[model samples]
Target: MAKGLKKTVVLVGMMGAGKTAVGKAIAQILNVPFLDSDAEIELAADRTIAEIFERDGEPFFRTKESQVIERLLNDERCILSTGGGAYMRADNREMILEKGVAVWLKVDLNILWQRVRHRNTRPLLQTANPYETLRDLAQTREPMYAKAEIVVEAEPGLSVEQMAQKVVDALVAHGGIVKDT
Candidate 1:
């Protein structure tokens, strides 16, 4: 339907939680821009996130991440997909709350594992015991993720379009968007 957004939708969650995928679909539905904080950071750093972590480390990458998030939040309202760890910081969470409505895509551990297990792109999951690592991350981050303004539970077997529509419906219900979902 291409309904426009009244507020920026900041997609936040774990690495395999479908933030980027659902965000792209949401932007298309809303006729708005889809901005990924991680992608922006990569463009600014001229390197991959993995490379950034390898060379400069997580703290440095997080600093650049905060800067990029601030810049994007100040731009036109868009569907902003953030890195998995972005919402873990208090400053980042505060800024997101002020400028946009945060949507946490809550997915089950098994589903998240299935989605990300084969992918080497996630720097954090590159561990000796990747499955255990993913489980631990989900456990640790769930509390922070629960602080998001809107929580959209991602059910298994739903297509990206379906998941996006669910988010849109949630936004309308929460008054985050003035649109027909």
Candidate 2:
């Protein structure tokens, strides 16, 4: 990591894992722009994520997601929070790894359920049993998420600010953020 080179910090994890919130905080701390993949998709498609899923389908949504992510990766300095399923795909994960540092916001299943249970927006978890769905998804994606350069656990009792600070620290520790000489 050259000090003069621009760095992009990409946050990857399950839905409701606080990637958007924490990524925004990290970007503010680093004084850089923050881009949420879902928001970008919504802006480009002129429809909410749920609407995209409903009207088109997961495959269609994923295609748009890949396009948005590809565009975002071109930014030299940015904090990007990707959709939950984005990193699960091999090509997407490889692209992030090649372009920047990927950080996995690891959250426990119980905590994830608590945060997202009431939300009706998650297309993947729209099942009759969202908890089980979350558990299965988490299990399946854990290995993929582990491929990230940095991993920060989003524990209970930590404010978003605290989580953001932890992410910054992890980035420094993992050599993701190099100080300009």
Candidate 3:
């Protein structure tokens, strides 16, 4: 962790855990650019995530996702917010860890359900039993998410700003901002 190396702050967590919102706040505080992988994918594909999944399928969307993430990792400084499923893939997780410090925006399942239930765009939650699907996804991803360099709890009652500050504080505490290699 040298002082000259580009520092990247990457946020990973379940859907609706406020990664995009918090990543923006962190970027503003750190005076760096914020990049959301999902948004980048949408921009590159010229379609929404739901449309990509529906028209091309999950595999296609994931390929695009990995590509976007790889490009972003080349940056020297950025606050990156990844899709919920991104870290579940081995290569994605390894690339993030190698290129930057990853922060897990942890949120409880109940809170996640409340935030995501009405969003039909979430392919995994589009099942007839969304609750069960969410529960399963959360369970499966929690361990992987926990492997992040830092973990910040996204409490239901806390404002996005508060969570953002918490992430920054955690980054500072964990020696996340390092010099270039």
Candidate 4:
């Protein structure tokens, strides 16, 4: 495991960008805690994200997501994986920027589509034409994602561990965020 992380690493991107999986691997390698804002929300609400969306609404879900993200950012230095839409809100983005290192995982639409197509868990993609919805969401969000301090491309066919290592390498090479204890 690696050590001596100066700040929390917040993983942000689309739903299928592997934020949770890669964040878990990165946290394990860094010997830091892994926090998923979605999981936290689910635990707190006693319901799945989809259920929450169905019950209250997207506005309610976004509010809860922001709250959970703020709470998580205030916690110990760790790897935090946020819901795909978390960073879209300015308040949430500000909180993440203030409290953690935001790394946007950039993946192509086809790759993202492939990863998310089979899964019916995405609230936003629960549309009549999910593929087009995803594409449109990606287009709208790419500019905001580009505002992140670091950008790590998601290569097709890479294992989760490799993707995590790639993020580590990006941190070391670009910002020196992680170092030997």
The lDDT values for all models are 0.92, 0.87, 0.86, 0.91
Error of 3 at 148 (Å): 0.8
lDDT of 4 by residue, 1-181 (tens): 4586778899999999999999999988888899999999999999999999999999999999999999888888889999989889999888888888899999999999999999988889889999999999999999999988999998879999999999999888876578688
Candidate 4 vs. true structure, TM-score: 0.96
Model 2 steric clash pairs: none
In model 1, the runs with Cα more than 4 Å from the true position are 179-181
Q: Which ten residues in a row have the lowest lDDT in candidate 3?
A: 1-10
**For model 1, how does the per-residue alpha-carbon lDDT over 1-181 read when each residue is reduced to its tens digit?**
6677777899999998999999999888888899999999999889999999999999999999999999999999899999999999999999999989899999999999999999998899899999999999889999999999899999989999999999988998898464544
Residue 34 of candidate 2: its Cα lDDT?
87
lDDT against true structure, model 2: 0.87
Where does candidate 3 stray beyond 4 Å? 1-5, 176-181
lDDT of 4 at 85: 90
RMSD to native for every prediction? 1.5, 2.5, 3.1, 1.1
Better of 2 and 3 by lDDT: 2
The backbone clash count of each candidate, in order, is 0, 0, 6, 0
Residues 92-150, model 2: lDDT tens digits: 98888888889999999998999999998898998888899999999999999999989
lDDT leader: 1
| Per-residue lDDT of candidate 3, residues 5-28 (tens digit) | 256778999999999998898777
